[model samples]
Target: MDLDMAQVRAFVHAAQEMHFGRAAGDLGVTQQALSKRIGRLESLLGTKLFERLGHGVGLTEEGRRFLESARRALAASDDAVATIAGKDRPLRVDVWGHLYAPTRTLLQVAGRADELRLELGHGRDLPGAMTALLRGDIDVALGRIHPPLSPGLAHRLVRLEPVDAVLSTDHPLASEPTLRPEQLRDSVLWAPGALERLDFLRRFADRFGVRERSGSVNLGLAHFLTEVAVDPRRFSLVPADMPLPDIPGLRSVPLVDPTPLYAWSLLWRTGSTHPGLSTLAAACAGEAGRSRWLEYDPTRDWLPDLPTDRAEAHSG
Candidate 1:
């Protein structure tokens, strides 16, 4: 009995995305091709794996059961192929902090890398991605890694991104070329979730004397910026390098005199040999050096904690 790995892989992506068009885009295949691949896979398995839904696809019982086995099969195949052709298998990577467009860091490195084949997903946040990492659901994740990572995980500090203060054009400080963190004390710290749970913002507010806070849902960057543009007293932070949407009546001002730095790290499980691990790390290192991404000055910049140890050096 022989199974086509391509068909299996197409099915896996379709299952993960639950949207045929998105799955096709992820696979770099046309939608028709992806649908055909899924059809072939279902025919070979003699089971219906997905139910057509009004919006996206839903996994049937068979698909839910087969997902685990499919992942294992891919892992086994990847491991076997790594001995000779590691680049052939796609390395699963997850990223978070979409509000800041984390892919700006990833795609820059990915554009320069030639050795790695990647499949990227948005894990939404650090905690979510960490859970997936511990469970072996992904090969790598890129995000802000705070301390207390689970055992068997390793991390490499990849980038130090300087964040800017986003405020309404009507804000009193908006006209200033650069504002200090202390200036935000007069304004409300708008955020997605509770201030206590938002580690970075909470710490920043605690240290900077921002006592007032309020915000809406944790929507994407545009929505958050739009919300900021609504009130002159509300402000938030965003990566300075990220491209901002052309929303009306919003201004992004740089926060100086110890600017907050969002540390982006590459995380993976230790002791499990994934061939692309070293390749991806090397690629990140290369891009970091070429782009000066890891530059952090204690006097001019701020981070919640000191730099994390590189791959295999430390784990929680």
Candidate 2:
């Protein structure tokens, strides 16, 4: 049978995205067209490649195995085209969310890559970053990936860091080296975005009975953190290891009992062809294993229901 590269490409993207619509968008084709291509491919192969999911799509066992060969085929084709065209370019990447120093995580990724050429940028938040990814502005993005993400994007969780509260050293709670969630219930939850936009922080505040919430314009982490230090009743959280500037009277304290963790994921367009995409994934996975970046204990940690849970559900 003559294989259609278009059909093979559709299958690979749909398998990666787990969504027919997303794969179609990446291919710049209508979803119906993408579906037809895959259907034709399946008919030719005499095997079903995908199983429809209620919310998206999934790979059948055959589809999963077929993906390995499909990728190799596409890689060879891409390499041949690249060789003829001489269109090599640096991989563009970005990070979103302001609370944590994205550089800390990005540096780790760069460190593990053998030979890397990158063009780095920043996104305002997840929604903003999602736009950049959809527009092809960046090859990959690093940030929290709480849904509702656009179907055009696919992601892999790479980091989960325990969070700590930042407040004035003068705050009554600051006297304690470690505080628990309940201790902050009476204090204001200071956040950089509208609570509606920062769902993770909103969920956290609601779960821990933090009634009074406050928002600050994200001038930057240092400025927002300084505001936290100025108001004894206001507190904000950051990834535990993110270094804070030496703002006088500001103190960072760990939360015990049930610590909340900030989740980070590497996101990309489902059909991205950047050579650095896999290198970044391998680096993130390797560092996660070495640093226990994705480790979590339900009994000891607090996290909002995340995309990983839904992904696991889709597979099941």
Candidate 3:
């Protein structure tokens, strides 16, 4: 079957999003234009590609089978371009972060001028980052995956850190090294919208019948810290490992019962041809970035012990 690179790539993206409008937005194309292109490709293939489900779309069985081949074709095209351009030269890549640590490591590793010309974009949340990735506006994304990733995106789990309830050190609960969800009902809770969809938080909130009452706060981490710090009586929960300021007497206690753990990952478009991205993916899979964090306190990660490379100690 004859196929053009652009149409195949567009089809793969639309299938991944399962919405023509969203897919077009990701590709930076108008919905009408994207529709015409898909129509052209469908005509060439002599099959219907999507079933419009009133408000959205779904792939036909044939579209499902064609998706992987289309992605591979795009990857091959990227490889061919990279070969013509030479790998030794700096590569251009885009990365987005929405208050996740994996995002920081991605920027630190990819932004090195010697290896890559990295373009850094910051989003307020995971949806925004994923949208940018699908649109090809960003090549890599450092973000959260509460529901996990869709088929066309690749994810590498980097770290799983516990959550802490931030409050004034003088608060009654501050003295305790850890506090359970049931014990936190009396304290004012601050729920950042970005984390609202997180499984741990949702589960914990549901158990206590406190999900509806929780106030939505700023999505940005720095703003979150400032708001909580300013209000001595109010508290916000965040990843326990993220550094916070000691404002005279502010303290953070680990949430015991819920033990909310944030799963961070490095996400990239599956068809990436950039050699540096592949290197980063392999390194992350090997957990090369784990050793850089504060010495793993057993109190934090309760998992069975795993060995890490000492070389990672000095790399970061």
Candidate 4:
């Protein structure tokens, strides 16, 4: 008998959640609708797959056995669809912060501009972007990550960009050819809350003895510049390659002593076999090879081992 993929999907979700209501919600279907779908699936298989409990559901032995097969079947179906319609479907990519220009350039140079529909996610910080990638909400992500990189995801180094100190032109250190972290001890550094969550930032802040003030996620570039412009005592850090908003009062100065670098990576699901993903990876590898800005050494682990206290502090 021909089995319905929708019914299989409902069964899989229901099995995973063990709560019909939650599974239905996840599938964007009403509880009653989900119940009917599961019922239909059980009937098709000529066996009960779940035991309805007082508060929740539990899978039958047959269901436990069938789950593996169901998952494989669903994955196969997805692969088939992707293979057939991949070019027409948008390849969702998440670009953290202001690295959009370079990433767009890479994609365009890869000849992906015409072949793949590009859905770009901007403004998401690294953690948020990685979460999206893990959830399969997006296909790829480009961002600076302090690694001990998460398991089950694959990544490639796009570049190691020098982190710059962004300060008001009036600030004492603004005219210095470059800055040492120690020089900023008297100034308050402003970073978005998301950026501050990074272990690298936490270590950098602690080492430098600089006070960090974090702006809320809703703070736009204009507001950020205005905040810096009004207060010479406030500064911020950004990737040197990032184009600063032409806010008249702000200047970007390179950081020198123990120069910190922002490592940008292209990340995707570890075992993803999608042709589009492979194409993008190949392009990134090629570009990294040819470009002077990109440092191509996958063997190097850039994330420093965080002390217990520092790790706990940055965990937030």
lDDT of 1 by residue, 8-58 (tens): 878778887899999899778999999998898999899999999999999
Clashing pairs in 4: none
Stretches of candidate 3 exceeding 4 Å from the true structure = 13-35, 51-69, 85-97, 100-117, 123-137, 177-182, 185-188, 194-196, 203-213, 217-219, 229-234, 245-250, 254-261, 269-271, 281-316
On the 0 to 100 scale, the lDDT of residue 55 in model 3 is 84
TM-score of each: 0.71, 0.71, 0.67, 0.69
User: Which regions of candidate 4 fall more than 4 Å away from where they truly are?
Assistant: 1-26, 35-77, 98-117, 126-128, 147-151, 194-200, 296-316
lDDT of 4 at 216: 47
Per-residue lDDT tens digits for candidate 2, residues 86-205, read 346767888887568776898887887867677888888888887666545577898888868876568887777789989998888998989998899999999997888887889999
Q: What is the C-alpha local distance difference test score of each model? A: 0.82, 0.82, 0.62, 0.68
At residue 107, candidate 2 shows an lDDT of 88
Predictions ranked by TM-score, top down?
Answer: 2, 1, 4, 3
- Give candidate 2 regions above 4 Å deviation: 1-87, 309-316
| lDDT, model 4, position 111 | 68
lDDT over C-alpha atoms for residue 202 of model 2 = 94
lDDT of 4 by residue, 98-130 (tens): 522446445544563345456777745667776
Clash count, predicted structure 3? 1
lDDT measured at residue 42 in model 2 versus the true structure, 0 to 100? 98
How far does residue 67 in candidate 4 sit from its true spot (Å)? Answer: 11
